[model samples]
Target: MYFERAHISDGELLAFYKALLYPRLVEEKMLLLLRQGKVSKWFSGIGQEAIAVGATLALDNDEWILPLHRNLGVFTARQMPLQQLFHQWQGSPLGFSKGRERSFHFGSRQHHICGMISHLGPQLSIADGISLAHKLKKEDKVSLAFTGEGGTSEGEFHEALNVAAVWDLPVIFLIENNGYGLSTPVEEQYRCEQLVQRAAGYGMRGMRINGNNLLEVYHAIKEAKRHALHEQQPVLIEAMTFRMRGHEEASGTKYVPPALLEEWARQDPIQHFEGFLQFLQLINEEGIHDIREALKHEIDREINTALAEVSPPVSEADELKDIYAPAPSPIPPVAGAATHDKRFIDAISEGLDQAMVQYPNLILMGQDIAEYGGAFKITDGFVARYGKERVRNTPLCESAIVGAGLGLSLMGYKSMVEMQFADFVTCGFNQIVNNLAKIHYRWGQTADVVVRLPAGAGVGAGPFHSQSNEAWFTHVPGLKIVYPATPADAKGLLLAAFADPNPVLYFEHKALYRSISGPVPEAPYTIEIGKANLIQTGDDISIITYGAGVHWALEYSKQHPQLSIHILDLRTLLPLDYEAIREAVTATGKVLILHEDTLTGGLGGEISAWIAEHCFALLDAPVMRCAGLDTPVPFAASLEKNFLAKTRMHQYIEQLANY
Candidate 1:
């Protein structure tokens, strides 16, 4: 027999009490383990357990949640196995990260939680993507993400909130105002009096609530979800809570005033919630005591079992294992298929058109990509055909847009992000390199995203507008890089990029977009990602190149016909077509690695080193490199011509042939 509580049943209140109690017991035990040297570090959410517990319980089980480092209650409240959580903390083999990561630094797809990286605010945009997927699929699901008062200072914080509001995505951005960000005081973090005010500025409803009050947090989130799902709006919530301990155990709390610590200590959330329940008759004093003891005992047993279990096995094979998930096999191109001449840009556009008809789950996101049809007009009129939901026009928020694309892929949808110019990708570099690239290796989650990089120089667009940045992404693991050199390959490679389950950075040369025309397949097809296309063959010297340099190889061959060059177009930069490279090197002992990027630290350097190690004895000459000069792209055509690898660099070819 039980009475009603504030807008919740007595049973619900009892549920809240148990939910809040477990995380508290676990945090206290973690702190003990930290001192005892059983655990290396701990992020204690001791005083603010209610925020994580209450918010998680408020959401539907199927809805996604991205929790921060300090929010362990989200995991416990979801009923994630206690042993698995302990394993994650202790770096046991049974951990979410298979013991590669020690804290709540990784996420569980089964638990429907996306975990945050050290770059705190990036997860906000990732949450935007998960919600975007739900909205696109017409699923009645709202996504919630956590951030700290200090994390609000990040650029991603603004971008995520702005995009979510602009798109009217079903997202709940909860800001845990713990009053400090790694010892930086709240006063220093912002000029405004409250974080919620910024939400209004973004044209979204803003709410500020007492985070320590479990019922208030639960009700607020419950209502926020309702508003988001029913009305298709995003809400920003500022949960007023306190960080009861150091940012980590290493960063001591000596900066805080003694009186403030005492005040917050007296207002401990677990104690407050216990007292409130006692007053409501949801639980008597004995019930509260029994709950804490039982939870503590449960944690104690789980920790003991986890402690005895072995750590994850470490091996070089394990280190190199599963960086990229098994890519989808490419749909082979038709044999002797009917073809018509088309521009490089049109071929790309056609590929996207066919991919859309195929994937249905494919989403296009970038600045001005919908109605305006993208900067280069590659997606021109796409919004009319596919509609705005699928052909999304993102704001100038590159970071959030890219993060949202990652979220879309996490939920079994394929997404393409057009970085207006490849040079502009720096804005979203962290999301690409750290989040998208590392996600598969870090947590066994494949990021099925295709980032369309409109790259290359010689377009007179200058440094900001023109850059061959394929080398940057190629350096990172867990990403596929494709650089198509012809209209046919452009269409075929794009289809391939979209088909691949792993993340792909497809580089399309700006200079070749409309300037070049060739036969392209009328229907959808895919060229395998790692394979190279042999444009022409010769025995004297092999010129290995891709993208704009492929044209360079063809031009050099026409200019110096007597030399006889084997021109190879490496459509894929990463996975490097080493087999073709080896064959080229073996056939003609003289090889020249030509590229459009800078001479130093270009992909050529890595290719040269690789060839030297494997195919050195076969070489008749030093692997010559003719590349763009190491300087910012000059606007002056005269200056840029000197910077690029042109036919005039015939000396290198002659020298290689003679040697």
Candidate 2:
């Protein structure tokens, strides 16, 4: 089948060559900077420059692009300054002196190049959702997401492709088959001979092209973009290219077979494309030499100019610059008294009902948030109460569900994404981490989104449904992690998160949904997102914990009369309550940190580090940490108990008393 190409006029062809030449020169300059220890690390798309240049030339400058780590070529084609790009690689605070962010997480709203993600495959889903948004908004823009062959292994790739195809979204999935995924070759990564065939499974058109051939790459991308913009159908283009450099500066080609490397080098995209230009008489040898020398001098001058620019002193006070959009006239907790009291499930239902009444743009989406009112029935009667538009059900794809929420949130919608079970959150981790958690930090605080995960291990849910994985998110900056233990706190935190300027991961302990009931106000309310709640006060010891552990610590305190256990219920885990913890630990002279996550890298370790550094002298004993065993939550009920740390409160108290 013949596919037509658009936007490859002589002017565009020249532009593609110019873009490739410019970026290659800068890449070489940056490589020298790395070797000289001026830059930290880099992943260069040295040999595959044509694919990036051609794809960008075919793409609309106003449209969105989500590139993977080895996409400096695409970024340069989009006119990202080589100097700023170099400043980023050099580990200079001036790289992001505008805010606190990493080098690779760069995206200019003005340029419409949605930031790049270091992780693999997840960007595909994000690109799909953003394209869906453009369609919904009736815009002509299309989205292009690029990844390696190895990224196809990720379930997110399948989820995003399925959604894009099913909805006929305007998105192009660019699979740059550069022979290998790091050290593993494409053949080893998938049994299929051609990566484009994978698109057929998603009901999308798939095509293969010679990525090393500049003309072929340009024509293929143009065809893909034409189909995307006009038909509004997703297409997958598998460009057979070669990786000429190591995965990163730290990685070496020592593991690669010498013969294989030699053969691939013969088909290097730059050399192949340059030869093709000569064959077509598009440019002579003198033109090629002039372009190369001009690009090198321009890049060299840019590097010197950027380096000469003063590095703004990084101030500690500036740490809060883009943490979250400043709350517009603080959303004070509702002043009215509680008319009715209920469990966590009822509180969430009531909060959603209230939000629908208040904000017309608010949306509730999850596996069963609409008809089922959520798997745990938290949104029970929501569909009937607010209609399907406000309360929506989604396909089983968690990544797409969350990515869609992010898209809606970007369009000024108050979107809440629900994960039926916290343990299953790994399915959407890429969406949460790569897109939602870091969006505001990357975009300079323009994103406001909320994701709710029903977490904690209980009720014999087994490994797939029961887990307390809050620690994984707490470790990430620019994401607010909240865990509410009671019905009142749950409702308050949910409202606060909606009002919050940044993305929030609201972790609702599944066991506490209906297990614990409390008085909840009907009006709008907000409990501070980062502050800890002192549930009880005592002298001898302080039990610092959050979520289900707070209730467990209280129970232990009741069981033991000798130990006066002060319990601090940390509602928000990310922006930890260091001051409150210090005061409590200093007053009590001892500390015991507890959580439900696995012991290693758990919240307890972070809390222990804080107490050790801040309250060392007041310690009666070394801080004690009690967490789940470092193993998967088991399927068997008895084995699950063994894996969990329930009934350890009494044992922990006894140990603390002895210490």
Compose the digit string of candidate 1's lDDT tens values, residues 580-604. Answer: 9998898788899899998888998
Positional deviation of 619 in candidate 1, in angstroms? 1.6
lDDT string for model 2 (418-529, tens) is 8888877788877787777777656563556688888878778888888888988987777889999888888888888888767889998888878888888777777888
Off by over 4 Å in 2: 1-13, 31-42, 96-105, 229-231, 246-293, 313-330, 356-363, 383-414, 430-447, 462-464, 536-543, 549-567, 586-609, 616-659
TM-score of each: 0.97, 0.83
